[model samples]
Target: MAHLELTGLCKAYGAICIADRMSLSVPEAQVLGIIGPNGAGKSSLFNMISGDVQPDAGTISISGRDTTGLPSRRLAKLGVGRTYQIPRPFGGMTVFENLLVAARFAGGLGASDARKKCGEVLEATELSHLTDETAGGLRLLDRKRLELSRALVTDPELLLLDEIAGGLTDAECISLVAFIGELNKAGITILWIEHVLHALIEVAHRVIAVNAGQILADGSAEDVMASKDVREIYLGSAEALA
Candidate 1:
Protein backbone atom coordinates (compact mmCIF):
# COMPACT_ATOMS: atom_id res chain seq x y z
CA MET A 1 0.00 0.00 0.00
CA ALA A 2 1.11 3.56 -0.56
CA HIS A 3 2.60 5.15 2.53
CA LEU A 4 0.83 8.45 1.93
CA GLU A 5 -2.44 8.97 0.07
CA LEU A 6 -4.48 12.02 -0.76
CA THR A 7 -7.84 11.03 -2.12
CA GLY A 8 -10.35 13.51 -3.49
CA LEU A 9 -8.64 16.37 -1.72
CA CYS A 10 -10.43 19.67 -2.16
CA LYS A 11 -10.34 23.04 -0.47
CA ALA A 12 -12.10 26.35 -1.04
CA TYR A 13 -12.07 29.75 0.57
CA GLY A 14 -15.16 31.77 -0.28
CA ALA A 15 -15.20 31.65 -4.09
CA ILE A 16 -11.63 30.51 -4.46
CA CYS A 17 -11.20 26.82 -5.14
CA ILE A 18 -7.58 26.21 -4.13
CA ALA A 19 -7.49 22.45 -4.50
CA ASP A 20 -10.05 20.75 -6.71
CA ARG A 21 -10.32 17.15 -5.70
CA MET A 22 -6.64 16.47 -6.25
CA SER A 23 -5.51 12.93 -5.60
CA LEU A 24 -2.12 11.21 -5.50
CA SER A 25 -0.38 8.37 -3.75
CA VAL A 26 3.25 7.99 -2.74
CA PRO A 27 4.80 4.67 -1.88
CA GLU A 28 7.14 4.18 1.06
CA ALA A 29 10.59 5.81 0.85
CA GLN A 30 10.03 7.33 -2.58
CA VAL A 31 10.69 10.91 -3.58
CA LEU A 32 7.86 12.85 -5.23
CA GLY A 33 8.30 16.39 -6.52
CA ILE A 34 5.64 19.03 -7.02
CA ILE A 35 6.07 21.78 -9.65
CA GLY A 36 3.81 24.58 -10.74
CA PRO A 37 3.55 28.29 -11.38
CA ASN A 38 3.08 30.83 -8.65
CA GLY A 39 -0.28 30.59 -6.84
CA ALA A 40 -0.72 27.02 -8.00
CA GLY A 41 -1.84 25.89 -4.55
CA LYS A 42 1.49 24.15 -4.00
CA SER A 43 2.04 25.59 -0.51
CA SER A 44 -1.64 25.17 0.25
CA LEU A 45 -1.34 21.49 -0.48
CA PHE A 46 1.53 21.23 1.98
CA ASN A 47 -0.48 23.12 4.58
CA MET A 48 -3.34 20.66 4.21
CA ILE A 49 -1.09 17.60 4.42
CA SER A 50 0.80 19.03 7.40
CA GLY A 51 -2.56 19.88 9.02
CA ASP A 52 -2.02 23.62 9.07
CA VAL A 53 -5.13 23.94 6.93
CA GLN A 54 -8.09 21.60 6.86
CA PRO A 55 -9.57 20.68 3.54
CA ASP A 56 -13.21 21.21 2.84
CA ALA A 57 -13.30 17.70 1.38
CA GLY A 58 -10.89 14.76 1.12
CA THR A 59 -9.11 12.05 3.02
CA ILE A 60 -5.39 12.12 3.92
CA SER A 61 -3.81 8.96 5.11
CA ILE A 62 -0.31 8.13 6.32
CA SER A 63 0.74 4.50 6.50
CA GLY A 64 -2.92 3.66 5.77
CA ARG A 65 -4.19 5.54 8.81
CA ASP A 66 -6.54 8.43 8.13
CA THR A 67 -5.07 11.79 9.20
CA THR A 68 -7.36 14.24 7.49
CA GLY A 69 -8.12 17.35 9.52
CA LEU A 70 -5.73 16.32 12.28
CA PRO A 71 -3.91 19.15 13.98
CA SER A 72 -0.34 20.04 12.93
CA ARG A 73 1.02 18.95 16.27
CA ARG A 74 -0.70 15.61 15.92
CA LEU A 75 0.64 15.13 12.41
CA ALA A 76 4.19 15.93 13.52
CA LYS A 77 3.90 13.30 16.22
CA LEU A 78 2.79 10.88 13.53
CA GLY A 79 6.20 11.36 11.84
CA VAL A 80 5.25 13.92 9.22
CA GLY A 81 7.89 16.67 9.29
CA ARG A 82 7.66 19.73 7.05
CA THR A 83 9.75 22.81 6.19
CA TYR A 84 8.40 26.11 4.95
CA GLN A 85 9.38 28.04 1.82
CA ILE A 86 10.88 30.71 4.03
CA PRO A 87 13.19 29.49 6.79
CA ARG A 88 11.81 30.60 10.16
CA PRO A 89 14.49 29.97 12.74
CA PHE A 90 14.20 31.43 16.22
CA GLY A 91 16.28 34.61 15.94
CA GLY A 92 17.14 34.81 19.61
CA MET A 93 18.40 31.26 19.82
CA THR A 94 21.66 29.58 18.82
CA VAL A 95 21.63 27.21 15.87
CA PHE A 96 21.87 24.20 18.17
CA GLU A 97 19.28 25.61 20.51
CA ASN A 98 16.81 26.12 17.68
CA LEU A 99 17.07 22.48 16.65
CA LEU A 100 16.94 21.37 20.29
CA VAL A 101 13.66 23.22 20.73
CA ALA A 102 12.22 21.67 17.55
CA ALA A 103 13.19 18.21 18.71
CA ARG A 104 11.60 18.72 22.09
CA PHE A 105 8.41 20.39 20.90
CA ALA A 106 7.75 18.62 17.64
CA GLY A 107 9.20 15.21 18.32
CA GLY A 108 8.47 15.20 22.06
CA LEU A 109 11.99 14.05 22.79
CA GLY A 110 13.40 14.01 26.31
CA ALA A 111 16.19 16.45 27.22
CA SER A 112 19.12 14.13 26.63
CA ASP A 113 17.53 12.56 23.59
CA ALA A 114 16.70 15.95 22.08
CA ARG A 115 20.25 17.16 22.58
CA LYS A 116 21.73 14.07 20.97
CA LYS A 117 19.23 14.21 18.10
CA CYS A 118 19.96 17.88 17.54
CA GLY A 119 23.67 17.14 17.39
CA GLU A 120 23.14 14.40 14.86
CA VAL A 121 20.88 16.55 12.71
CA LEU A 122 23.36 19.43 12.69
CA GLU A 123 26.15 17.10 11.69
CA ALA A 124 24.05 15.59 8.93
CA THR A 125 23.15 19.01 7.62
CA GLU A 126 26.81 20.17 7.78
CA LEU A 127 25.88 22.79 10.39
CA SER A 128 28.07 21.38 13.14
CA HIS A 129 30.60 24.17 12.59
CA LEU A 130 27.91 26.76 13.19
CA THR A 131 26.35 25.14 16.24
CA ASP A 132 26.90 28.14 18.45
CA GLU A 133 26.07 30.78 15.84
CA THR A 134 23.01 32.89 16.50
CA ALA A 135 20.13 31.97 14.21
CA GLY A 136 19.72 35.65 13.35
CA GLY A 137 23.25 35.78 11.97
CA LEU A 138 22.91 33.01 9.42
CA ARG A 139 23.14 33.81 5.73
CA LEU A 140 20.61 32.53 3.21
CA LEU A 141 22.15 29.13 2.52
CA ASP A 142 22.92 28.42 6.17
CA ARG A 143 19.38 29.44 7.11
CA LYS A 144 18.06 26.95 4.59
CA ARG A 145 20.32 24.27 6.01
CA LEU A 146 19.09 25.11 9.49
CA GLU A 147 15.51 24.67 8.30
CA LEU A 148 16.25 21.19 7.02
CA SER A 149 18.12 20.37 10.24
CA ARG A 150 15.12 21.38 12.28
CA ALA A 151 12.89 19.08 10.25
CA LEU A 152 15.38 16.22 10.43
CA VAL A 153 15.68 16.50 14.22
CA THR A 154 12.18 15.04 14.41
CA ASP A 155 13.40 11.81 12.79
CA PRO A 156 10.49 11.78 10.38
CA GLU A 157 9.51 8.94 8.12
CA LEU A 158 8.01 11.42 5.70
CA LEU A 159 9.56 14.80 4.92
CA LEU A 160 7.77 17.66 3.22
CA LEU A 161 10.08 20.33 1.78
CA ASP A 162 8.87 23.61 0.32
CA GLU A 163 11.33 25.63 -1.79
CA ILE A 164 14.44 24.73 0.19
CA ALA A 165 16.60 25.52 -2.84
CA GLY A 166 14.88 28.64 -4.05
CA GLY A 167 17.54 31.19 -3.27
CA LEU A 168 20.67 29.10 -3.63
CA THR A 169 23.36 29.35 -6.26
CA ASP A 170 24.06 26.61 -8.78
CA ALA A 171 26.80 24.97 -6.71
CA GLU A 172 24.83 25.20 -3.48
CA CYS A 173 21.72 23.86 -5.18
CA ILE A 174 23.66 20.88 -6.50
CA SER A 175 25.01 20.18 -3.02
CA LEU A 176 21.54 20.39 -1.50
CA VAL A 177 20.13 18.10 -4.19
CA ALA A 178 22.82 15.54 -3.42
CA PHE A 179 21.97 15.76 0.28
CA ILE A 180 18.29 15.12 -0.38
CA GLY A 181 19.08 12.22 -2.72
CA GLU A 182 21.20 10.67 0.02
CA LEU A 183 18.33 11.04 2.47
CA ASN A 184 15.93 9.33 0.08
CA LYS A 185 18.41 6.52 -0.50
CA ALA A 186 18.36 5.98 3.25
CA GLY A 187 14.61 5.17 3.09
CA ILE A 188 12.78 8.38 3.92
CA THR A 189 9.73 9.29 1.86
CA ILE A 190 10.00 12.83 0.51
CA LEU A 191 7.41 15.18 -0.96
CA TRP A 192 9.17 18.25 -2.34
CA ILE A 193 7.57 21.39 -3.74
CA GLU A 194 10.12 23.42 -5.65
CA HIS A 195 10.32 25.93 -8.49
CA VAL A 196 13.86 24.76 -9.30
CA LEU A 197 13.14 22.43 -12.20
CA HIS A 198 16.68 21.13 -12.65
CA ALA A 199 16.98 20.37 -8.95
CA LEU A 200 13.65 18.54 -8.95
CA ILE A 201 14.64 16.65 -12.07
CA GLU A 202 17.82 15.63 -10.32
CA VAL A 203 16.20 14.25 -7.16
CA ALA A 204 12.68 13.14 -7.99
CA HIS A 205 11.76 9.83 -9.57
CA ARG A 206 8.33 11.22 -10.37
CA VAL A 207 7.12 14.76 -10.83
CA ILE A 208 3.61 16.16 -10.23
CA ALA A 209 2.51 19.45 -11.67
CA VAL A 210 -0.32 21.48 -10.22
CA ASN A 211 -2.01 24.49 -11.78
CA ALA A 212 -4.92 26.58 -10.57
CA GLY A 213 -5.67 24.01 -7.88
CA GLN A 214 -5.64 20.92 -10.10
CA ILE A 215 -3.03 18.36 -11.09
CA LEU A 216 -2.06 18.92 -14.71
CA ALA A 217 0.60 16.27 -15.10
CA ASP A 218 2.27 13.43 -13.20
CA GLY A 219 4.86 10.90 -14.28
CA SER A 220 8.61 10.49 -14.66
CA ALA A 221 10.48 13.79 -14.64
CA GLU A 222 11.06 13.72 -18.40
CA ASP A 223 7.53 12.54 -19.09
CA VAL A 224 5.87 15.21 -16.98
CA MET A 225 8.02 17.96 -18.47
CA ALA A 226 7.13 16.63 -21.91
CA SER A 227 3.39 16.53 -21.27
CA LYS A 228 1.36 18.88 -23.45
CA ASP A 229 -0.56 20.32 -20.53
CA VAL A 230 2.54 20.85 -18.43
CA ARG A 231 4.38 22.47 -21.31
CA GLU A 232 1.48 24.76 -21.95
CA ILE A 233 0.89 25.62 -18.30
CA TYR A 234 4.40 26.28 -17.02
CA LEU A 235 7.26 24.15 -18.35
CA GLY A 236 7.56 25.95 -21.67
CA SER A 237 7.56 29.31 -19.96
CA ALA A 238 9.82 28.25 -17.14
CA GLU A 239 13.13 28.35 -19.01
CA ALA A 240 13.26 32.14 -18.73
CA LEU A 241 12.73 31.90 -15.01
CA ALA A 242 14.75 28.75 -14.39
Candidate 2:
Protein backbone atom coordinates (compact mmCIF):
# COMPACT_ATOMS: atom_id res chain seq x y z
CA MET A 1 0.00 0.00 0.00
CA ALA A 2 1.12 3.56 -0.63
CA HIS A 3 2.36 5.42 2.40
CA LEU A 4 0.41 8.46 1.28
CA GLU A 5 -2.23 8.70 -1.43
CA LEU A 6 -4.52 11.32 -2.88
CA THR A 7 -7.28 10.45 -5.32
CA GLY A 8 -9.65 12.63 -7.30
CA LEU A 9 -8.67 15.68 -5.25
CA CYS A 10 -10.47 18.82 -6.29
CA LYS A 11 -10.06 22.29 -4.83
CA ALA A 12 -10.89 25.75 -6.10
CA TYR A 13 -11.23 29.34 -5.04
CA GLY A 14 -13.70 31.32 -7.15
CA ALA A 15 -12.57 30.51 -10.67
CA ILE A 16 -9.07 29.49 -9.67
CA CYS A 17 -8.59 25.75 -9.51
CA ILE A 18 -5.68 24.58 -7.42
CA ALA A 19 -6.44 20.89 -7.72
CA ASP A 20 -8.22 19.34 -10.69
CA ARG A 21 -9.03 15.76 -9.94
CA MET A 22 -5.39 15.38 -8.96
CA SER A 23 -4.14 12.00 -7.86
CA LEU A 24 -0.78 11.03 -6.41
CA SER A 25 0.95 8.45 -4.27
CA VAL A 26 4.25 8.15 -2.44
CA PRO A 27 5.75 4.83 -1.49
CA GLU A 28 7.19 4.25 1.95
CA ALA A 29 10.60 5.82 2.61
CA GLN A 30 10.79 7.38 -0.85
CA VAL A 31 11.62 11.03 -1.39
CA LEU A 32 9.30 12.83 -3.82
CA GLY A 33 10.23 16.19 -5.28
CA ILE A 34 7.75 18.69 -6.69
CA ILE A 35 8.53 21.67 -8.92
CA GLY A 36 6.23 24.22 -10.46
CA PRO A 37 5.86 27.91 -11.27
CA ASN A 38 4.92 30.64 -8.80
CA GLY A 39 1.14 30.15 -9.14
CA ALA A 40 1.20 26.52 -10.06
CA GLY A 41 -0.51 25.47 -6.81
CA LYS A 42 2.45 23.64 -5.30
CA SER A 43 2.14 25.20 -1.87
CA SER A 44 -1.62 24.93 -1.97
CA LEU A 45 -1.27 21.23 -2.61
CA PHE A 46 1.01 21.01 0.38
CA ASN A 47 -1.53 22.87 2.47
CA MET A 48 -4.26 20.46 1.51
CA ILE A 49 -2.18 17.42 2.25
CA SER A 50 -0.94 18.77 5.56
CA GLY A 51 -4.50 19.77 6.55
CA ASP A 52 -3.99 23.53 6.47
CA VAL A 53 -6.53 23.53 3.63
CA GLN A 54 -9.26 21.08 2.75
CA PRO A 55 -10.09 19.83 -0.69
CA ASP A 56 -13.56 20.46 -1.95
CA ALA A 57 -13.61 16.88 -3.18
CA GLY A 58 -11.20 13.99 -2.73
CA THR A 59 -9.77 11.26 -0.64
CA ILE A 60 -6.47 11.30 1.20
CA SER A 61 -5.29 7.98 2.47
CA ILE A 62 -2.32 7.20 4.62
CA SER A 63 -1.41 3.55 4.90
CA GLY A 64 -4.68 2.66 3.21
CA ARG A 65 -6.87 4.47 5.76
CA ASP A 66 -8.80 7.50 4.60
CA THR A 67 -7.62 10.68 6.36
CA THR A 68 -9.09 13.45 4.26
CA GLY A 69 -9.99 16.74 5.91
CA LEU A 70 -8.19 15.89 9.11
CA PRO A 71 -6.83 18.88 11.00
CA SER A 72 -3.11 19.56 11.19
CA ARG A 73 -3.02 18.48 14.82
CA ARG A 74 -4.77 15.24 13.95
CA LEU A 75 -2.45 14.67 11.04
CA ALA A 76 0.45 15.15 13.41
CA LYS A 77 -0.72 12.13 15.36
CA LEU A 78 -0.76 10.14 12.16
CA GLY A 79 2.95 10.71 11.62
CA VAL A 80 2.72 13.70 9.30
CA GLY A 81 5.00 16.67 9.91
CA ARG A 82 5.06 19.74 7.70
CA THR A 83 7.05 22.95 7.35
CA TYR A 84 5.71 26.10 5.76
CA GLN A 85 7.28 28.27 3.10
CA ILE A 86 7.23 30.97 5.75
CA PRO A 87 8.36 29.96 9.21
CA ARG A 88 5.82 30.56 11.99
CA PRO A 89 7.53 29.56 15.20
CA PHE A 90 5.99 31.01 18.36
CA GLY A 91 7.59 34.43 18.61
CA GLY A 92 7.47 34.59 22.41
CA MET A 93 9.07 31.22 22.94
CA THR A 94 12.74 30.40 22.83
CA VAL A 95 13.98 28.14 20.04
CA PHE A 96 14.29 25.19 22.38
CA GLU A 97 10.98 25.90 24.01
CA ASN A 98 9.19 25.98 20.71
CA LEU A 99 10.58 22.58 19.81
CA LEU A 100 9.72 21.23 23.22
CA VAL A 101 6.14 22.27 22.70
CA ALA A 102 6.03 20.48 19.37
CA ALA A 103 7.67 17.44 20.88
CA ARG A 104 5.20 17.29 23.71
CA PHE A 105 1.99 18.17 21.92
CA ALA A 106 2.51 17.38 18.29
CA GLY A 107 4.73 14.37 18.91
CA GLY A 108 2.68 13.22 21.87
CA LEU A 109 5.81 12.52 23.84
CA GLY A 110 6.13 12.40 27.59
CA ALA A 111 7.98 15.20 29.42
CA SER A 112 11.29 13.40 29.69
CA ASP A 113 11.17 12.12 26.12
CA ALA A 114 10.13 15.53 24.81
CA ARG A 115 13.04 17.21 26.55
CA LYS A 116 15.50 14.71 25.14
CA LYS A 117 14.00 15.01 21.66
CA CYS A 118 14.15 18.81 21.74
CA GLY A 119 17.77 18.72 22.86
CA GLU A 120 18.76 16.43 20.01
CA VAL A 121 16.73 18.55 17.58
CA LEU A 122 18.41 21.74 18.78
CA GLU A 123 21.80 20.23 18.20
CA ALA A 124 20.80 18.79 14.83
CA THR A 125 19.52 22.15 13.61
CA GLU A 126 22.58 23.98 14.95
CA LEU A 127 20.45 25.95 17.40
CA SER A 128 21.96 24.45 20.56
CA HIS A 129 23.73 27.67 21.50
CA LEU A 130 20.64 29.78 20.84
CA THR A 131 18.35 27.52 22.86
CA ASP A 132 17.38 30.33 25.21
CA GLU A 133 17.02 33.05 22.59
CA THR A 134 13.50 34.04 21.64
CA ALA A 135 12.50 32.84 18.20
CA GLY A 136 11.69 36.36 17.02
CA GLY A 137 15.25 37.47 17.68
CA LEU A 138 16.73 35.06 15.20
CA ARG A 139 17.83 35.79 11.64
CA LEU A 140 15.89 34.55 8.61
CA LEU A 141 18.02 31.43 8.19
CA ASP A 142 17.74 30.60 11.84
CA ARG A 143 13.98 30.94 11.64
CA LYS A 144 14.06 28.54 8.72
CA ARG A 145 16.14 26.16 10.76
CA LEU A 146 13.64 26.39 13.59
CA GLU A 147 10.79 25.78 11.17
CA LEU A 148 12.42 22.55 10.04
CA SER A 149 13.32 21.69 13.62
CA ARG A 150 9.71 22.02 14.69
CA ALA A 151 8.71 19.45 12.15
CA LEU A 152 11.56 17.07 12.89
CA VAL A 153 10.90 17.02 16.62
CA THR A 154 7.56 15.43 15.85
CA ASP A 155 9.35 12.29 14.70
CA PRO A 156 7.09 11.94 11.70
CA GLU A 157 7.10 8.92 9.47
CA LEU A 158 6.14 11.17 6.56
CA LEU A 159 7.75 14.60 6.24
CA LEU A 160 6.42 17.44 4.10
CA LEU A 161 8.87 20.24 3.38
CA ASP A 162 7.82 23.34 1.44
CA GLU A 163 10.55 25.51 -0.02
CA ILE A 164 12.74 24.67 2.94
CA ALA A 165 15.87 25.43 0.93
CA GLY A 166 14.71 28.69 -0.63
CA GLY A 167 16.73 31.32 1.21
CA LEU A 168 19.79 29.35 2.28
CA THR A 169 23.31 30.06 1.08
CA ASP A 170 24.74 27.55 -1.39
CA ALA A 171 26.73 25.89 1.36
CA GLU A 172 23.76 25.95 3.71
CA CYS A 173 21.59 24.43 1.02
CA ILE A 174 24.03 21.60 0.62
CA SER A 175 24.02 20.92 4.33
CA LEU A 176 20.24 21.02 4.54
CA VAL A 177 19.86 18.72 1.55
CA ALA A 178 22.34 16.29 3.03
CA PHE A 179 20.41 16.36 6.27
CA ILE A 180 17.21 15.61 4.38
CA GLY A 181 18.92 12.69 2.70
CA GLU A 182 19.77 11.38 6.12
CA LEU A 183 16.14 11.65 7.21
CA ASN A 184 14.97 9.67 4.20
CA LYS A 185 17.69 7.11 4.77
CA ALA A 186 16.47 6.78 8.31
CA GLY A 187 13.12 5.57 6.87
CA ILE A 188 11.15 8.78 6.63
CA THR A 189 8.99 9.38 3.58
CA ILE A 190 9.56 12.88 2.24
CA LEU A 191 7.45 15.04 -0.04
CA TRP A 192 9.32 18.23 -0.77
CA ILE A 193 8.31 21.19 -2.93
CA GLU A 194 11.51 22.95 -3.92
CA HIS A 195 12.40 25.76 -6.28
CA VAL A 196 16.01 24.81 -5.84
CA LEU A 197 16.08 21.90 -8.24
CA HIS A 198 19.77 21.19 -7.67
CA ALA A 199 19.21 20.66 -3.99
CA LEU A 200 16.00 18.66 -4.47
CA ILE A 201 17.62 16.42 -7.05
CA GLU A 202 20.21 15.32 -4.55
CA VAL A 203 17.67 13.48 -2.39
CA ALA A 204 14.45 12.99 -4.32
CA HIS A 205 13.95 9.45 -5.52
CA ARG A 206 11.27 10.59 -7.98
CA VAL A 207 10.33 14.00 -9.39
CA ILE A 208 6.97 15.44 -10.40
CA ALA A 209 6.32 18.73 -12.12
CA VAL A 210 3.04 20.46 -11.48
CA ASN A 211 1.44 23.12 -13.63
CA ALA A 212 -1.87 24.76 -12.75
CA GLY A 213 -2.49 21.97 -10.23
CA GLN A 214 -1.96 19.22 -12.75
CA ILE A 215 0.85 16.74 -12.92
CA LEU A 216 2.81 17.97 -15.92
CA ALA A 217 5.41 15.27 -15.67
CA ASP A 218 6.31 12.35 -13.42
CA GLY A 219 9.48 10.30 -13.70
CA SER A 220 13.09 10.16 -12.70
CA ALA A 221 14.62 13.55 -11.99
CA GLU A 222 16.48 13.64 -15.27
CA ASP A 223 13.46 12.51 -17.26
CA VAL A 224 11.06 14.88 -15.56
CA MET A 225 13.40 17.80 -16.06
CA ALA A 226 13.66 16.91 -19.73
CA SER A 227 9.91 16.52 -20.29
CA LYS A 228 8.67 18.78 -23.06
CA ASP A 229 5.77 19.87 -20.90
CA VAL A 230 8.00 20.55 -17.92
CA ARG A 231 10.45 22.45 -20.11
CA GLU A 232 7.68 24.68 -21.40
CA ILE A 233 6.47 25.29 -17.87
CA TYR A 234 9.97 26.31 -16.86
CA LEU A 235 10.23 28.33 -20.11
CA GLY A 236 13.70 29.61 -20.93
CA SER A 237 15.14 28.23 -17.73
CA ALA A 238 15.47 24.90 -19.52
CA GLU A 239 18.57 26.35 -21.13
CA ALA A 240 19.95 27.02 -17.68
CA LEU A 241 19.33 23.39 -16.76
CA ALA A 242 21.51 22.25 -19.65
Residue runs of model 1 more than 4 Å from their true location after superposition: 235-242
Question: Top model by TM-score, which number?
Answer: 2
lDDT of 1 at 85: 87
Against the unseen true structure, what C-alpha lDDT does each candidate score?
0.92, 0.92
| lDDT (Cα, tens digit) per residue for candidate 1, span 21-48 | 9999999999999999898999999999
> How do the predictions measure up, each by TM-score?
0.94, 0.96
How much is the lDDT of residue 161 in candidate 2? 93
Q: Candidate 2: where are CA atoms >4 Å away?
A: 236-242
